[model samples]
Target: MAARPIGLRWKLSAAIALVSALVALALSLLVHNAARASMLDSSRDAQDERLEFALRAYDSGGQLVFDARLDDPTLPEPLRRAVVKGKRATYVEERGDGPPLVWAASQVGDQVMSLNGRFADRDRALRRMDQVLRVGSVLVVLSGTALGILIGGQLSRRLRKAAVAARELAGGATEVRVQEAIGRPARDETDELARAVDALADALRKRLEAERRVTADIAHELRTPVTGLVTAAELLPPGRPTELVRNRAQLLRTLIEDVLEVARLDGAAERADEQEVALGEFVRRRVERLDPEAAVEVTREARVRTDPRRLERILGNLLSNARRHGSPPIEVTVQGAVLRIRDHGPGFPQTLLSDGPSRFRTGTTDRARGHGLGLTIAAGQARVLGARLSFRNAQGGGAEAIVWLPAQAETDDGTPGPGSPGPA
Candidate 1:
């Protein structure tokens, strides 16, 4: 079988979280880039203003008077040369131990007075801003992940309810309803989906009910004529004509019986009468009853609590199917709560595996006759017994049908009566 799809909640949560993280990362980069440029411009402007102030205070100081802050020896040589030639100059100078300084020089009379200041405070401010932005970016992404998980969980819960309702409908629930999401109410796509599913289920139920009614009426109407035909065929002379007539009547009767049984199964008229069944002995007895030549191989001892009648019906149909559609020394093995019935024959058709058996498929050819209802009836009976029946093509070449029973019941004699309670 193809792998099951992942749930909607987790997919939604992951998508939202990824988008949030990308958005936060982009915003952080944009803010950090703009801040970097702005910080550099502000530092340059402040240095220029400081240089202008120092030059104004030292006017006409032919002896090269300078303020204590601007009198640093780390000024650039080009700035000093420009002052000596009675010109103005500005340059940036860096020292080994501190932040870069902005230096300006001008000549007053024949002496040179230079202005310079370190940009240490501006660099410190920019570094602090960078640290803050980094911390904020991390927090944003973390918060987004948590929010995604919360929203995803809510979406998953609503989607799962719709899924459950659909499953109930598939399992023959005549009146399945999609439940509205719990908590805060809102009209959204999820709500619309729930409405659509309920509508589809209602439509399906009506049509199926009509089809079932038609089938039941036809089966009931045929019973009287089939009884008469069977009696008339029995009274006829012992010849081929009588045998053929009798066979036709028998086939028709079996079809009618199958239809009625299916109707009962659908109407919930069947209930399991759970009883302890010894796996080894039960397998041997059932195989002997159905096909005397078929091989019975019980490798493990086990006891299961289930309806034995349903279990027998299920096994009988499977064996009949094997004989009709397959060449077999049909092999049946009981291992724990699992039973395997395999036949050496052409394996299951692709259509049968994909879509299951149709009740009306046996109406045509010899090979398609009674084999049509075999697997279908087995599946229905298995469900009645709360067991799982699966079909597969075995290795080499053959068809395999496996029945997985319910939990085993622990008992002393392994043959507890129907009403005698056993340990579950």
Candidate 2:
């Protein structure tokens, strides 16, 4: 037969109740015994005082006299006999006109009383105390058991919430939260466990985001150059000269370089060398280098701590994307550790605006020209550098990208001046 599994709460509560019952039982027994002994001693003391009073009365009057009445109403019915020097003495009292009474008296003036009534009374009282103690012990045990069960139930409920939260997290519900209504504080084990589960879910979400971005970036980088190469090849004359073929090949090589750069950015293959770069200067330089004829403008002065090469790649990709998909006249501005890039292009598609960033989203642009990985890579790069990136359509018909860098590299004046370097 299989053994039944006991729950922790029940086991703990049972153990506590058992211990409490044992202690209460022992204490009740001790109290009952003490009470019984005290009652017996009191009965004997009252009998002795009565005998002494009778002896004094008989000695003082010199007439064999005794009081047949007891001072205590609780005294039991018993024969009082007095014998002097082994001879029993007869006594007559005015209080009782019935038959004479005799008792054996000891040499030391001790009198012996024999009766079942006193013993019976003591026995009855002891029995009553025993019943009361038994009832009280039972009440104590039950109350303790109830208290233990209540505490155990509360703890079990909290632990169950944590377990359910863990299961939900494992099932890919990153937003699941454990209920904290059990009164356990945040520093307690249950709360700590809930926090750990939440952290795991957040980590999984970030990892998934990174993976999706990488995949989209790869497809976008590959499609652009391949399409260009195919188009150039088809346009070549049937009997093209070697010079024409060489020019087309050079174009293919440039396209390959561009593709390789995008690939490197996605793969994080660039080396990290720390540098202090002025954000304003870097943005202006990148805009000039990439698209001098595109009517690009720069504003604001900010400094950043980063690896120069990686930062350039991040900005370069953003600029290239805007030039390809946007309507031109790009605006780049930096303030403090924040950089804003806006293009006077057809703003993001309604779907993308609503959904935010998604995998392989082209944002209302032609598929052949824009594969939608550029923003994804830029976002990933920003994340790698501990920055937050956000996208939104400008009030005027255009799209705007904002990157907020880490606080450590910002100027004390809350502005990034020209002459700061790239991300480290």
In terms of lDDT, which candidate is strongest? 1
Off by over 4 Å in 1: 1-46, 63-100, 103-114, 160-186, 362-368, 410-424
CA RMSD (A), model 2: 14.7
Q: Relative to the true structure, how large is the alpha-carbon lDDT of every model?
A: 0.73, 0.62
* Total backbone clashes of candidate 1, pairs 3 or more residues apart or in separate chains: 0
Q: What TM-score does candidate 1 get on C-alpha atoms?
A: 0.78
Could you tell me how far off, in angstroms, the CA of residue 153 lies in candidate 2 after the best superposition?
A: 14
lDDT of 1 at 221: 93
Q: What does candidate 2 score on TM?
A: 0.43
User: What is the C-alpha local distance difference test score of candidate 2?
Assistant: 0.62
Tens-digit per-residue lDDT, 1-424, candidate 1? 9999977666776787788778877887888779756765666566656656666665545222235234346556777776677666666665677666666666655555566666677768767877887788778767777787788777777777778877877877656677443334457777777778778877877787777788888888988899888898899999998899999898888888888777667665578998887877998998898899899987666777788888898888888888877787789987667788899988877667676666656423565456366677788887778777878888988888888876754433564322222222
